[model samples]
Target: MDFRWWRRSFFGAFLSWVFFFLRFSCSDKACAAPEYTFVKEATSAPPVIFYDYIIIGGGTAGCPLAATLSHGGATVLVLERGGSPYTNPNITNIGNFASVLLDRSPTSPAQPFTSEDGVYNARARILGGGSAVNAGFYTRASTHYIKKVGWNQKMVKQAYEWVEQVVAFQPPLMEWESAFRDGLLEVGVLPNNGFTYDHLYGTKIGGTIFDKEGHRHTAADLLQYANPRKITVYLHAIVHKILFRHIPGTARPQAYGVIYKDAYGVRHLAYLKRNSKNEIILTAGAIGSPQLLMLSGIGPGYHLRTHGIQVVVNQPLVGQGMADNPMNVLLIPSPLPVEVSLVQVVGITKFNTFIEGASGLSFVYPLARRLAKRFRLFLNQSDYEPFKVPPEDMARAVDTVNAVVNRTLRAGIILEKITGPASTGHLELRNLNPDDTPFVTFNYFKEPEDLRKCIEGMRTVISVVNSKAFSKFRYKNMPIEALINLMLTLPINNRPRHATAAISLEQFCIDTVMSIWHYHGGCQVGRVVDKEYRVLGVDSLRVVDGSTFYRTPGTNPQATVMMLGRYVGKRILQERYLSRRSKHKN
Candidate 1:
């Protein structure tokens, strides 16, 4: 195997998309950036610095939060475990979607981990977080979801618009996406509600972060709204632990500073300014937030003691209620060429399920061949449905132009995922190492209600595949059992799945479950944090990302997650400023 050939074959199409990102001047409004001077490499920070706020994780929520907190001249320090998204071609180019997700490198933007449930999943390791790596579909939370979360309705709308102006776009539907939309409606999925950003139940095209030119505009672009002079973002700065101490009159421990290590492995301390109501906020997504809390001795007392971590607060709920939307997909291996696209058209159903799709992702096969060998997993395509092998199969198909390379085995995927998975799990520390992924189990389909939704959603998918619009792609009746075995990678108890009808579709739903990358909770609002997102047992500490949500917002959570940052940032400004004025009068 020529490693050089693999490198060329892999990056050939990706390098072609470089022209779309060559000129990066934030001055152009279409580019969705500003003359931002705030970002600096983590190594550039001093040994110690006191600031108004120390935000951990420069991700989907962290970026906007930092930008909004910069208003009225307050300083913000954002510590990110990953590198900047600005210069990384993998983060900027849509063509590299599958490749980035398939990348198993220690520093890849999409960090891969296998859960305790034996399911493979990826989490963001870039400044833009999941937005830098996801399907880029943008939809607001349902009006009811917003109200249920107890957010100020007007402020939520205002925050969403602020983010939309910079990142979200009315994506142009390509041939594949256009047909996918028609297929949804033809199957009676909905009332054909055209293009809209609201979370309406029906077939419609939603906003995307990818522009007409196909370059991705991630949540990092939201930083253009930040006052550059007041914010400093440190990339590759992994916070080792949150520093806490008992205040003289406070009821519980107060977070005052954090100890982080730069890429060079040198430790640095960032703290809040004295007595002015400053705080340390954790916007480190669902996984990272709870992991950080446990590492900082703020989790369950017994668990912390096993690792020799002296308990600060015995918060038993630090890593509880972890949930991820279970995605089940069927592939259409097409002989004809299809345009490469992400999630543009979605079929929101009344059964608490969402049907979405992607096309022309043929680039992942050869790469999958390599990944299969690397992970020591058998690449038996005989049972596989098509291009993107299931996560359980240890391979992810990248969406490269198959026609460019004269490949005929192109493919598209029509995936259905349940919204409120209802079944949840917990997160636990594998070790004290912040660099290592913590143990998380989503316990897919553990609840009977989740399985019921899967059956209903699968039935809807069958209808969509049988629609007249999709007839041309259906080469033959591919066995559901093969898709289950190929996707779930479940070993037989001396029983070959394809040889016999040992598995039913209902059992397949339970066996073939995979993550849609919408995993959230663990540090949920009422359990771990207050309505204001402040940590319940600690002062000057807050958790402000998806981990706070009891359920994901709408069809996707990126838009709402980003909005939460701006919304919360605005609230902090209002409350903190009043406190500052009151203290001055004294």
Candidate 2:
């Protein structure tokens, strides 16, 4: 029998099959890779663009939502006011954390502005939004928050996983972060939660978007999820207004399109498809969303009319309840160089305060020096009292002081933030012009309870620094009391020494408090949008960013913002499918 010939034939056939499999597998890999087609200028775009979903502000929320919707075969358009994050080193590099915020260019991802209270604040303008410029700390919303917000718990978990797969990273604990973690525990921050992506009580180390090599993975990275052929992204596309149409007898106004400008100052219009379940979503952060709504005639009726904007919905709460987490820093100047890190370890206290630590080379020295000069002016005369010196000036002073300490000494700065400030502020129209920044007032320390909590947070910082864990690195000359006294100088006016000192400390906080950039609550649920995230008085429009948060969660808001973005995307897809099925049945 010819058994050898049979075996040889089988082996030949097996080899041919293997080669065929290899060839097709390589081809499949090439096909699966995303090929993005971005529009860099508005002038290059078609005269008018149409999409099933148009998202304004290609930010943390907008990017993910666009990616999700586009992946589901929906034609999506993303309008971003700033340049692409891919080319911005300040946004892509973890070491440029301070530099991004320090940049004052008109196109910088972080757009710096002064609030009415004179506090210096910044809003993200880049495609990745706050995720591109923030400190990169990442953590999920509390289970309590998920329940309160009426989100599907199972779907929320999936959403977190979907985001984490691409952007979240486990930060390696360096020496400084390790010491900070120990100090937090020694001071009774207690029950170390360890490395996790979940929000937990006491001292815990959460996920970061910065990887091991010091590269940042922003929400812009999530754009990889997009089916590029179905999505169109326009950078430097500044949305000026959401065009609305009111039916003759209907009580609600319909948003049909958006008008925006390109970098070349050329205007363009993007409209939703007619006679379809198309929608326009606003993910323009806490400040920009409300400001845009007011511009579109959706804010307070009289306020819009004052600026010559025709009334549309007359939603008085559009920009009414703005709030930001107030933060203060205590610089611990170390003689030795400290390891560089971001918000790797956080101490969650019972008083609604969060203590975060960072140690690295100071990046904003020049800006800090300028702020220091302003602080000197603030201290010079009685006319320049705490409230008199505008919040922006005071914010500059506080930031300058922190920067100076960081630059002058090779040291670590222990920053304490009041996560849940009792006093809330508001945003108002500076003018009717869409290009002008909105007038913001944080009204920090307006509530006695907020002030007391801040004081306690400051004390906690001192205690952590004085703990045995930090004894090896603590500067001997910097006595806690002396440092506090130096930083909190005030005019003594015929009062007892104790009263004078107490008053001075309080004034120091009022003058130096700044927004940690955790701003939220403008187009909040029960106010501007409903639980489904739809604008109350507008059809085919939704708000899905930090602006829609009912209240600021206990930790950094970036993770939660991403989660909600994913959650809303899923809901939109579900609703679209249901609508299709209903139509088919009819």
Candidate 2 residue pairs in backbone clash:
117-391, 118-390, 118-391, 118-392, 119-391, 119-392
Model 2 CA deviation exceeding 4 Å by range:
1-35, 363-408, 485-505
Model 1 Cα shift for residue 548 (angstroms): 1.0
TM-score of each candidate? 0.87, 0.85
Error of 2 at 542 (Å): 0.6
Model 2, CA-based lDDT: 0.73
Candidate 2 lDDT tens digits, 91-205? 6655444556546667767776767765656788887898887777888888988898899999999999999887787777777778888999999998899998777778998
Worst 10 residues of 1 by lDDT: 15-24
> lDDT of each model, Cα atoms only?
0.77, 0.73
